[model samples]
Target chain A: MSEQFEMVPGNSLITKTPEEGRQLAVKMARLVIKATQPDSAIREKLRPIYSEDAAMLISVGQVVATEFATIAAANNYWR
Target chain B: MSEQFEMVPGNSLITKTPEEGRQLAVKMARLVIKATQPDSAIREKLRPIYSEDAAMLISVGQVVATEFATIAAANNYWR
Candidate 1:
């Protein structure tokens, strides 16, 4: 599955059209969600800390998405 | 300043002690916040779309943080 997924080049989304920007955001969101699945082995390891650090998790996630969106707009990827 | 900050290797935080995991999360949070500063040039480009995409941004941020925390626990970086 990893082989099937091509790595997105750094900041490439910044150059896409507005429509493309939204699409890219959606794609990224999906990927993040998949990586953080509750039952995943990674999640199990992280769970105890996460239970106490929910606020931090949310803040970090917001930053990541914000950066992507910013890259999109800076490059005029969005209309 | 960029030269002073070494790029953290992928998943290095995962192997850190529990205390180290918390430190890493805090560090990552700070970095992300700096990158997404509201008045930064990048933010200016991203603002309009973000105004409409606030939910997405929040969601994405949560995911990134969650993944980091997961990595921390998976590697026994956190107790």
Candidate 2:
């Protein structure tokens, strides 16, 4: 696999900080949003990563989860 | 980064089959559910991968997306 561990959509790696995690999640969410849109072109581009309905559900869930983490960090929940 | 492309939770790689992708998404959702529980021990184990609230949001979203994908494949939407 010609790949390196660069943070992309749906990755399970933990970020160094809460902010980093949130940002990564947001990026992933964008992929879902695009793939779900009513257009084949978008799907074609993202199909490699999100080639099924299950991927869409996971994408939506992940974005929400990451947002939760980001807000917690912002509100000093971790403190 | 000491990693290989294998199927796991919250992963964005497109699986060869829809079933495989859904299974992966479900695995990630479980991670979020566990991390959100009122226990630090579980979080400690998953911290390296889901280390923040943002990650949790993403986790939840991703699981749903995969489910959707799986269902679609089952219904022959891709056909």
Candidate 3:
């Protein structure tokens, strides 16, 4: 609950201490997952718009998944 | 001229109309250029920390440069 966790413009949540950054990255991962899920309505809308970069889109999805897993391991959030 | 140009997280300036997005992208490009210039102190500080992803860093630099050029063309800012 540091103010640094607050997503503000020109403020990078990833530049904090590793632990804090991991926590914030987890939150962002959750948002990205929800937004990009294949069956999700938003994803359906975004698919055509971002069709040219499908690989990059998938890579970002994987990055979010991996980051969330790392956060879960560190915080024991899923244990 | 619009509030959307503000660089705030949870508020993507790139989602605006192409013209507005281009303008905001130029501003971001300027910041990135300043931050990543070779022989610059900040780039020296970042180089060691981001050694593993040197290509990605360079790609971001190119993206900013290209976006700035696009903005300049559309707005006739350079002409």
Highest TM-score against the true fold, candidate: 1
**Model 2 C-alpha lDDT per residue in residues A1-79, reported as the tens digit of each score:** 1122222333332355667656655664544333223244633554454434575556555555754453344334435
Worst 10 residues of 1 chain B by lDDT: B48-57
Worst 10 residues of 3 chain B by lDDT: B1-10
Model 3 C-alpha lDDT per residue in residues A1-79, reported as the tens digit of each score: 2233333223444332333433354356545545446356766576444322323323333343345334334433321
Which of 1 and 3 is ahead in TM-score?
1
Order of models, best TM-score first? 1, 2, 3
* Better by lDDT, candidate 2 or 1: 1
What CAPRI-style quality would you assign to candidate 1? incorrect
Model 2 iRMS: 14.7
Evaluated on chain A only, model 2 obtains a TM-score of 0.36
Best-performing candidate as measured by lDDT? 1
Q: What are the runs in model 2 whose C-alpha is more than 4 Å off?
A: A1-7, A10-12, A38-63, A66-79, B1-23, B26-79
lDDT string for model 2 (B1-79, tens) is 2133233443453554433443444454544555456365855575444322233434445554555345334434222
Better of 1 and 2 by DockQ: 2
User: What TM-scores do the predictions have?
Assistant: 0.31, 0.27, 0.26
- Flag the better candidate by lDDT, 1 or 3: 1
lDDT of each: 0.45, 0.44, 0.40
